[model samples]
Target: MNKLYQSYLGSFTGLRKEIWLLSLITLINRAGTMVIPFLSLYLTKSLDFSLEQVGWILSFFGLGSVTGSWIGGWLTDKIGHYRTMAISLIGSSLFFVLLQVPDTFWTICLGIYLVMCVADMFRPAVFVAISAYSKPQNRTRSVTLIRLAINLGFSAGPAVGGLIIAHIGYGGLFWVDGITCLIAGLLLLKLLHPKKSVEEVEAPITSSQSAFSDRSYLLFIFTMILFGFIFVQYFSTMPLFYAEVHQLDEFHIGLLMGLNGLIIFLFEMPLIKYLENTKLSALMNVILGFLLCGISFLLLNLTGWIGILIVGMLFLTIGEMIAFPFSNTFALSRSDGKKKGSYMALYSIAFSISHIFGHNSGMHLIGNFGFAFTWYIMLGLAIIGILLLLILRKKLEKETIEISR
Candidate 1:
C-alpha cells in the first residue's frame, strides 16, 4: 500500500493524467511485445530454419537490440523520448510488415534483423521518459508499474499468439505484430510530451567517458550479463526442451509464461514493499533470487512433469522481480539526468548481448551435455555473478571511504 505503487492498479482513487497516459503507453507497447515469445516459432514454422539457424538469426535480433539501446539513449539526449518512440514504432511496424513478405531464408533473416534494430531503438527513449517523469521519491513505483505493464502483455501475448498460430497461421501473427506497433506508436504520439531541457534526466551510462566507469559498475554489469544469459534460455531453449524431451503442446508452453506474469502482477509490489531500506539487505534479496533461479533451472529436464516446469518458471519470476528492479534502481541512482538514457541503454545492451551468447551456447550444451549439464552452466554463471557482487560491495565501500575526504 505505498501510494505510488497503489497507482499501478489505477486504484489510488485519483490517478494523474500524466501517469494514466504513461500506463496506456505501457499497455500499448506490451500488447505488441507478446510477439517476441513467438519469434523462434515463426522462424521454425514459416522461415524453415533449423534450431541452430534460428539461434543465429535471433542473435542478430540481439545485436539489433544492443545497437538500438545505444541509439535510443543518444536520441533521448539529442531529441526526446516522444520522437524516439514515435520513430521506433513506425519503423518497427514497417519492418514487421516486411518480415511477413514471403522471401528466401537469408532475405527474411537480414530483413527481420534490421527490423529489430530499428524497432529496438525506442526502448531507451521510453525508459528515459519514465525516469524523467518520475520524482525521486516514487521512481521505484514507476519502474514497477512499467514492469507490470510488460507482464500484463506477457500474460496475454502468448495465449493470443497460440490462438493466432492455430488459426490464421504464422504470417497472420506477424501482421498482428505489425498492427500492434502501429497502434502503440499512435498512442504514444498522442500521449507523450517532449522534454525540452535536460535537467530532469537522471542516469548517464550512455557516454563513452570514464567518469561513469568504475570497478563496481563493471562487476555489476558482468553479473547482469550472467543473469541475462540464464534468462535467454526461456525463449530459445526451454520450449524446445519441453517439446522434444517432455512432449508438451503449445497451450502448456503458453500457460507457463502466463503463470509467470500472473505471479509478478499480484506479488511484485508486496514483495518489494516488505524489503527494508538497507542497501545490503536489498542486494542480498536480489542475489538470493538469482541464485534460486539458477538452481531451479536444472529441474527443467523434468519437463515430463509440466507441474514442475511451471514451478520452475514461478521461481524464475520470483527471482526476476526481486533482482531486476533493484538492479535498475541501483544503476539509475548512480546516474545523472544528462546521461540517464545512456546508462539504461548500456544496461539494456548488456542484457541483449547475453541473449546472443546464451542461446547459441544453450543449444550447444543441450545437444552435447543434455538438460542437466546445460543447467549446471547456468549454476556456474550464477555463482560467478554472486561472487562478483560481493567484490563490488567491497570495492564500493573502499571507494566511499576514499571519497569521504
Candidate 2:
C-alpha cells in the first residue's frame, strides 16, 4: 500500500512548482464557477426573463468567448502570459460584479457578453503558461494536472453553488464568483514571474505568423472541430437523454455527471504517466478516444437499463482522459514556444465553435428524427473523424520529429 502511494506520488515528480501553483489557481477560480452553469435558471426564475431572452443572453456569452479567445492569444504573444492572465482575471472579476446589477434584457445581455469576453481570455494565457513552465517531456502531465484540478473544482462548484442559491439566491452566486476570481488573480499576480527582458517574452520571426497560415494545423483544427462537435453533446444532449430516456431525477443526473469527474480524477494522471513514453502515439490514442465516445453513445441504443448509462459514461470518461490533454500537448509540440498562445487559441476556438454547433445540431436531430438516430449520427461522425485523424497523424508525427531534432 505504501509502495502504491509512493508510485502515485512519483508520477508528479519533476514538474515545476509553478505548474502546481497554476493548478491551485485554476481550482480556486473554477470552484466558484457558479454563475455560468446556472445562468439560464437564474435568468428564468429570479429575473423573470422568458426562454427566448435567456437564449439571446447566453448566445451573447458564447460570442464573447469566441472573440475573447482570439484576442487573448494575440495579447499573450505581444505581452506575456502572466500579465495577460492577471488582466483577464482581474478585469473579468469586475465585470462579474457589474453583471449583478443588470436586470433588463439588453442591459443583462451586454453584461453577459462583457463578463464572458473578459473571463474567457484567461484560457489561452493558461495554456501558454503551462507550456512555458514545464519541460517538453513533462508538458502533457502538467496539462493533465491542471485538468484534474479543474475537474475537482467542477465536481465541487455546483453542489456548493446549489446551497448558496437556496439560501442566498442569485446575487450570492455572483458575489462568490467575483470574489474567487479576485483572489485567484491576486495570488497569480504575486507568484508568476515572467522574464524582465522584452526579447525573452516575444515570439521569434520564424514562428508561424498566424495559425490559419499553417495547413497542417488547419487540418488538425478541423479534426478537433469534428471531435468537439460530437463530444460536446455530453454537455448539451446527454442530460436530456438521461432524463427523458432513463427517467432519472435531477439528483440521479447529478450523480452520473459527478461520476465523470471522479473517474478522471482517480485514473487519468496515472494512466497518462503509464502511457507517456510508450509505443502508443498521441494520435492513435485520440482516435481510440473518439471511437470509444461513439461506442458509448451507441451503447445507449442497445439497452434501456440505467446500468448501461454508467457503463457508457465510464467509456466516455476514459475517452476524455486520453483525448483532451494529449490534443493540447500535440498542439504545443507543433507550435513554437513563443507563438504557442496563437496555436492554442486556434485550438480553443474549435471548442467554442463546437459549443454553438454541437448543441444546436443535437437538438435539431433529436427534434426532427429521434434519440436513436441522433446516436447513430454521432457514431457516423466519429467514424469519419477517425479517417481524417489517420491522415492527420502523419503530419503530426513528421512535425513532432522535426521539433525533437
Candidate 3:
C-alpha cells in the first residue's frame, strides 16, 4: 500500500517550477469559472429567456472565443505568449464584469461574445507557454498537471457558484469570476516575469509546416471539433437535463457537476502515468477516450435512475482525463519553435468552432426531440469522431513512412 501510494505521488515529479506556477494561475482563473457552467440556466431561469434565445447567446459566446483564439495565436507569434496571456486575463476580467449589466437577449448575447473573445485569447497563449516551459518527454504529464489544476478549481467553483446563486444571486457570480481573473492576471505578472519564466526548453524540430498547410493536422482538428461538439454538452445541456429531467436544484446539480471534476482530480494523473508507460499511441488513447465518452452518454439512456447520473459522469470524466492531455501533446509535437502558437491556436479554434455550433444545436435538439435523443445524437457524433481520428492516424502513419524514405 505504501509503495502504491509512493508510485502515485511519483507521477508528478520532475515537472519544472514554471509549469507548477502556470497551473496555479490556471486554477485561480478556472476556480471562478462559475459563469459558463450555469450560463444556460441563468438565461433560462433568471432572465426568462427562451431556449432558442439561450442557444443563440451561447453561439455568440463561441464566436467571441473563435475571435479571441485567432487573435491570441497571432499575438503569441508576433508579440509573445507572456504579453498575450496577460492581456487576455486582465482584458477579459473587465468584460466578465460587464456581463452583469446586460439583461436583455441581444445585450446578453453581445456581452457573452465580448467576454469570451477576451477570455479565450488566454487558451492558445497558455498552450505555447506550456510547451516553452516543459521538457519534450514530460509534455503530456505537464499538460495533465495543468488539467488537474483546472479540474480541481472546477470542483470547487460550481458548488460555490451554486450557493452564491442560491443566496446572493447571479450578480455575485460575475463579481467573483471577474475578481479571480484580475487576481490571476496580476499574480502572473508579478511572479512569472517574461525574462525569467518564458525560457524555452530544447526540443528537436520535427516539422516546420504551417498549421494551415498540414492536411493531417487539419483533419485531426476537425475530429477534435466534433469531439468538442459532443463533449461540451456537459456544460451547456446536461445542466438543463438535471434541472428538467431529474428535477434537481441548483445545489444538487452543482454537486453532481463538481463530482466530475473531483473524479478527474483524483484519478487522472495516476491514470495518465500508467498510460504513458504503455506502448499505446496517443491517437489510439484518444479513440478509446471517445468510446468511453460515447458509452457515458449511452449510459444515461439505459436508466432513469438518478444513480446513473453519477455513473455516466464517471465515464465522461475518465474519458476527458484521457483525451485532453494527449491531444495537447499531439498538437504540440506537430509544431516547432515559431509555429507553436499557430498550431495550438488552431487547436483551440477547433473547440471554439465547436462551441458556436455545439451549444445552440444541443439546446435545439433537447427542445425539439428531448434529452434522450440529444444523448443519442452526442453518441453518434462521438462515433463519427472516432472514425475520423482513425483516418487521421492512418494518414499520419503514411506521412511518417514517406518522410523516413
Which has the greatest lDDT? 3
Worst 10 residues of 3 by lDDT: 197-206
Please write out the lDDT profile of model 3 over residues 1-405, one tens digit for every residue: 999999989999999888999999999999998988999999999999999888999999899999999999999988989999999999988888889998888888889989988999999999988888888888899999999999999999999999999999999999999999999999999887677553355754455678999888899999899989988999999999999999999999999999988988888999999999999999999998999999999999999999999999999999999999998889988776547888999999999999999999999999999999999999999999999999988898898899999
Per residue, candidate 1 scores C-alpha lDDT tens digits across 199-219 of 364443454543147556666
The parts of candidate 3 lying over 4 Å away from their true place are: 197-201, 204-208
Score each candidate by Cα lDDT. 0.73, 0.79, 0.91
Every model's Cα RMSD, please?
3.3, 3.4, 1.3
Please identify model 2 stretches exceeding 4 Å from their true place. Answer: 39-58, 100-109, 166-171, 196-205, 247-251, 395-405
Please report the TM-score between candidate 2 and the true structure.
0.88
- RMSD (CA, Å), candidate 3 to true, equals 1.3
Q: Model 2 lDDT vs. the true structure? A: 0.79
What pairs collide in candidate 3?
Answer: none
- Candidate 2 per-residue C-alpha lDDT over 1-405 given as tens digits, one digit per residue, 9 for 90 to 100: 999888888888998888989999998988878676566557766898754555456566666777788888888888878888999998887888778998899988788778877888888888988877887778899999999988777667766676777777778888888998999999887876675223223334474567788888888788888888888777656766776788865446656766787788888898899888688887788888888888988998998877999998888899889998888887887786337778888988877676556756776677678789999999898899899989988876797799999
